[model samples]
Target: MRAHRIALWLAVGQLACSPGRARTSSSPEPAAPVVVPAPTRETPRAIEPPPTVTVVSPPAAVEPTTPQVDATLIEGPAAPAPASPAQHARLLDSPEDPEPKLRGGIVKELEDVSYIVGNEWSLDAFREVITGLGGGYVGVGPDQAYLMMGWQRPEFAWLIDYDPKVMRVHAMYHALLRHCGSRKEFLAAFEPEATDAIAEVLDDAVADDRVRRLYRNNRDMFRWRLRSIERKLARRRVPSWLTDDETYVFVRELVLGGRVRALRVNLLDDLGMVGIGDAARELGVVVRVVYVSNAEEYWEQYAPQFERNLAALPSDARSLLLRTRLVWQVNRDYVYNAQPLQDFLAWLAAPGVETLEDVVGPKPPAQRDRINFVLTTARPP
Candidate 1:
């Protein structure tokens, strides 16, 4: 249809030449109104990526789909021997100090929505695979921040989601963690501003206009969220360093040092422009771990987009992706339709086996809360 709609002016011009005269068309009508919203959030980077993702007013245009190019998941002609624990520890660096630096866009249209994920329900199996890789980008689910904060200790960590608002929720928590030195102090930030004068004073800097606005808009939800995190932390078994004071200091250092960035990005998208993908390309970064909690289960049309995201990343051997899948029981009344994480680089190398069903197998596993760990490193660094 597009090709068929050529200018009738060409036909008309030919006829007019017979009379040796040309006619001009009237002026075109005004264009449609378009508005763009400014990018609402960016968690600090190892070296902060400037100050914005540049969300516009009317809304940004959809990003072009990335053309699928195959990457081999098979072993290469030669590979390097793995680094030893001592060398790996040197790569882990210290939690107290982080190298700050700067680091996609947009099928996600809703910027104001976010889910409140409290606990970081863990699968112990991922620890070795995750920790094996040296420092790089670490992306995780909406759960407890401590596990990744303590274990992976990537050079930079990004809390990613399809919802900008969800990222904003993380931003609020980052603010709390950065400013409040104790669990009590952090909890107090959500209390009525009237009562928590100390919290307001301490939290004031962290509580940017957007964070305060989110608090003002959904007063109850945000409060409930803060309480939920407190309860989750209270119940979990974590490293001693994760004690409230330690966690606060760690988070404070990370944010201020620009080693932690919370991005509201669709994992299925190319993510080349705004999130960790951009950081990888722009900064020559090698990402070691990316965790997507049960999100792949919800993908429909954008399903293949996940593959694109994996392809976009530049990685080294030992990189891991952690994901969760729900297993249903015959007698159970409730079950979630989530899938496990896979070695994305391997999936690309192997032939056949195209969809999630291939990896999860035919029947739902009998166990409860099983997590899948996939090796994503295609070759040695």
Candidate 2:
């Protein structure tokens, strides 16, 4: 029995050890795949891509280069622009530096003379008078003091005794009185000296001999002519009514009388006494005074009379007389017959109107027209 039991155990062990097969009972086979109804429209599905990974290396660095500067370029601060030609010229032409101020004392000295002389005398005359009084022109101080360089000249040293400024002032006073005298006679008395001074100045300035000779001739002729006229007027034996104040009054009254014709006739009749030449010469002066003092009447009477008188005189005499008449007329018109006879004489003595030709011949045709127009025009009351 034990052996039997052993065999059975061995058999059981062998059976247990052997792998057992699963039961062959089959599950029901899946129902034949019912073709899922094909979708009404077939749709394509997007395919998914597989994910990918990558590795990369770092990049290498490039070397840097230094910038270069251009040497020819104008890199420094800009230079100032050049000046234009006109600007340069103006700079060159500028006036020189002013002289230093004169000393106060010297200025005072000059002022003294200036106070007395004022602006009446010409600059040349002022200088001459100052120099004549032992004063040097240079180094003069305003206080009327002189700086002496040399001790030897006593003439200059005399300045120490007399004030040069005072002397100069006095000299100018005398000079003015001499040249512009109060009375006609006094002025006439100074004529010779005046003529000399004028001649000297002329000599220095006028280089042309013809012009100088012409000037001298005219002066001599005027003197002779005037003297001759005066002698004739003296012969008239008419008492002198032409004192400084009365002359203008007498002239004015005669012009007012429609007596321009009568006065002219009276003048012509007195020709023997007035000398034709002198009458002619004085005509302008007389008429001018008449015109200015009594312009309305003078124009009415004198303009026509002047034409008549001019016509009456002989051709040669006409020029001389006309010149004289013009002189009278200008004096009356411009000077108002207020000037002394001496002043009138000085004016005549000037360069341009020194002769008869200057009086009449050169008168423009326009002047004749103007004169005629005045004469024929109706009087202004």
Candidate 3:
């Protein structure tokens, strides 16, 4: 019994002497250590501070890296819109005239082009005479009217033609000028290969189906017309809207402002010219320049309606009538003449003055083979 008691005492001593089981009765127990997770390879060291041994939350789930892209580059460029007539109205003092109806002629096919690009090679000569006469302009034909308008800088311009096709031509001009960014862009829109592209632009921009159809059907003719004008102007060394960027911008702004209108007007018609005159008078705008373009030669006698049409137009002392006649005596295609508006009216009023021949009595003796301007005197007081 004594040996067993001694063995139990040795066992108790061994247990109490164990290093991990050692304890002091007067000391308190030590606290447990906090657990902190180590950062992964995915964690961005520059953006986050290093994790400490202290208690903390796990890092938020890392978002996948994405490539940034511009929205415009993804969607591509947007197409342009048509010119706003509302914007145009804000620039004008008077309201627009009511839309005029077709009065005289309708051309059916491209082959029927009487004056797509006129043969007035000498129109540049009139620039000096017409410049600075900036009221309202009434003219016939297409490019020549624009050339004269560019020179004169009219406040408002009426492109009146007997043929409806000419108005269609003007609509094409409106579309091209309104949408094209620069002179190069303008010329390129008229290229033969650009037919479908320009048709698309016109389709988007022009509201008139007739205008679009005319352009699509007669692409070759219109292209040829523009190219011919470019070549002609280049050959003549004339600084025109097509050839000059500044002039093109000037004319383009005018078209964009809605100051230009195309109408089907016949000089001898009872209603069309009379309506135009009434519109001008209502607007309080004078017709400073009237370009008849050989239409006077068509009549042998002064039709009373034609006389009334001329008389009806509001004019000032500076107002003039521009006409062209093929004087074979002068070696050019036409002799350009400017007659004072009042004098032309007086000649039409005179009983003996029957024809255009009586008004422009004779060709100049000295002028030959060159563009010449014949300035008619004012009516005798």
Judged by TM-score relative to the true structure, which candidate is superior, 2 or 3? 3
| Better-scoring candidate (lDDT), 1 or 2 | 1
Question: lDDT at 11 for candidate 1?
Answer: 20
Measured against the true structure, the TM-scores of the candidates, in listed sequence, are 0.54, 0.16, 0.67
Instruction: Tell me the tens digit of each residue's lDDT in model 1 across 46-140.
Output: 11011111111111222112122121122111112333444333323322111111111112331122334332223333444444244455554
Candidate 3 structure quality by residue, lDDT tens digits, 136-227 = 78888756777787667776777776655565678888889988967789888867688888888888887766666666655554555466
lDDT of 1: 0.40
Best candidate, lDDT: 3
Task: Tell me the whole-model lDDT of each prediction, alpha carbons only.
Answer: 0.40, 0.21, 0.58
Off by over 4 Å in 2: 1-195, 201-214, 237-381
Stretches of candidate 1 exceeding 4 Å from the true structure: 1-113, 118-120, 123-134, 138-146, 191-210, 216-236, 240-244, 272-275, 281-284, 300-304, 327-342, 362-381
Worst 10 residues of 1 by lDDT: 14-23
